[model samples]
Target: MPDPELPVITLEELGVLRAVHVRGTDSVEVELTPTYTGCPAIEAMSTDIERVLREHGMRKVSVHTVLSPAWSTDDISAEGRRKLREFGIAPPRVRQASGPKEPVAVELGPTRTSRPVAGPPELAPVPDPVCCPHCGSADTELLSRFSSTACKALRRCLACREPFDHFKEL
Candidate 1:
């Protein structure tokens, strides 16, 4: 049971801390999700969690690693978003699926021509899908998919030209 007074955050919201389940007074199970598929922080994080739980008198603490139900920016809570920005990282933008055949451009040839030429509109894509913390610029460009970690991407602000990390979209 979750405490009502305390704010509830998904494991992703906590970043390192995943799920904690209490089986009994002495037995407990913890589920951990890595920042990336090959993240090295897993060892350190697992040790830290173990130490903390042990300190709290969790005797039979078992840490289980889960990879399913992949992590996503949506899984991150508002508080998590705040923390990420504070840590100099941008959150992933929420992208809704557009309707099928959302016409970009439909060009009807010359006034007398009957041929119809349809092409994708040249509308500027969302620069920074997520709002940029630096310079408060939403206009951003994806620098690299691989940042310092696989879970983050290197993004550059078009207005500021300052590069920052963007949390991956799941």
Candidate 2:
């Protein structure tokens, strides 16, 4: 069930929630996808989940990896979002189209209408409509694309002049 107090994130943002199941009379299995293909927490997370399941009487627990659907922030439960915000990271923005536009061609000839040459592809997702956690300000600026952790980015609110971490959309 979804929680009401928090925002929502796509599954890609959550990265993976790996299905857990029983493999035998007392065994359990789980599937997962690393956040960046080589997440360092996989081993620890797997161990913790398995141990918890075993303590609940499961004899065995196995982990399986799935890469097709590719996780997204959309799958994050509302409760999870609350946890993230409570942990000081802003939840990812909801997915929405920015409106229709023409695609740029590689050829440099004057084939399109009047417009300046486009720049390289954006490496990071667009900034969230972020509000300051400290003073509830809408004015904010990106301080760094990467934070102390791989999943977060550093930002500062112009109104409150407070720095914060934002959970980047995957």
Candidate 3:
């Protein structure tokens, strides 16, 4: 089934549909991971899965929400990213590798609060610019941190001057 939020790509391509297993002749089990905790689409997705599977002749369909391996933006497939761009949404950058040797790293380089503190401010790591999916320009500015959906950020391209939603990094 296609992702409800980003209909341009299927749930399989989005990496949300983790696995499918057949317990018996007519019973099937599906594993799904949500993009984030308390994702609003999970219910809809689950219902869709059950209906589709049942229509396909499965007497019983069970969709289990798996949260052990938390979902990330990196879970998106290359094809899914291309579809997102074609759909006029900037895809998120791949931030981490999925391996036991490599772990998710966080760097609190610098921060500014109401008050100042200490020596000269240290520079934080700069993130690669989010390229405009339409104009293919790296000259885009964030208009809002949260767009129509919490998972996306609204931005406008300097070259095209068109406002668009960007799938935010998880």
Candidate 4:
């Protein structure tokens, strides 16, 4: 099915279409995972999927949204990354192993006992450097944290002097 957000890419290409199960000759069920929670395109995507199936003579079409396995940038297909780049949107960068280190205990008031101290891991935002899709340059600056959508950020390339959208990593 077609993706409602990026029309050039199919839902499979975007890696959001999870599964398709045929219940019978005229019945079908589809599973989808949204790229982000409360993504505006999700309802549109569901409607589009149902409409597409009905147009093809499917009597019963059901679209289920599953969120158990959270969506990640890594889930995006390689072709999807290429397509994003081709469309002037930088795909998410490969995550490195250099995320914030785990917390350590610190002694207090010369006491033998100490408690571990650190912010919640979930609250830490690991900033990944985005490359420029236009010139493939790593010398890019964040123009804004929010782009055209919540799932993206605006960036500008120093090399090409071109502004582009970056698919932010979740």
TM-score versus the correct structure, for each prediction:
0.67, 0.69, 0.86, 0.79
When 2 and 3 are scored with TM-score, the better candidate is 3
lDDT of 4 at 148: 82
Worst 10 residues of 2 by lDDT: 1-10
Candidate 2 to truth, TM: 0.69
Q: How far off is model 1, as Cα RMSD? A: 10.4
lDDT string for model 1 (1-170, tens) is 11111124334564445678998887788888765577676666667667778888889878877776544445566777776676667866544343332222333234322223344445423232555767768777766767876667788888888888877665
User: How much is 114 displaced in model 4, in angstroms?
Assistant: 35
lDDT comparison, 3 vs 4, better candidate = 3
Candidate 1 accuracy as TM-score: 0.67
The candidate that wins on lDDT is 3
> In TM-score terms, which candidate is top?
3
Model 4 Cα RMSD, 1 decimal: 9.6
Candidate 3 lDDT score relative to the true structure: 0.86
Cα lDDT over the full model 4: 0.79
Of models 1 and 4, which has the larger TM-score? Answer: 4
Residue 142, candidate 2: how far off, in angstroms?
Answer: 0.7
Tell me the number of clashing residue pairs for each predicted model. 1, 16, 0, 0
Put down candidate 4 lDDT per residue, 1-170, tens digits, no spaces: 66777776789988889899999899999999998788888899999999999999999999999995766677778898898999999998755344543332332332211222467767654344578888888788777777888888788888989999988776
Q: Point out the worst 10-residue segment of candidate 4 by lDDT.
A: 107-116
Cα lDDT of model 3 by residue, 81-150, tens digit:
9999999999998886555323556534222111224445454445778999988998888787788899
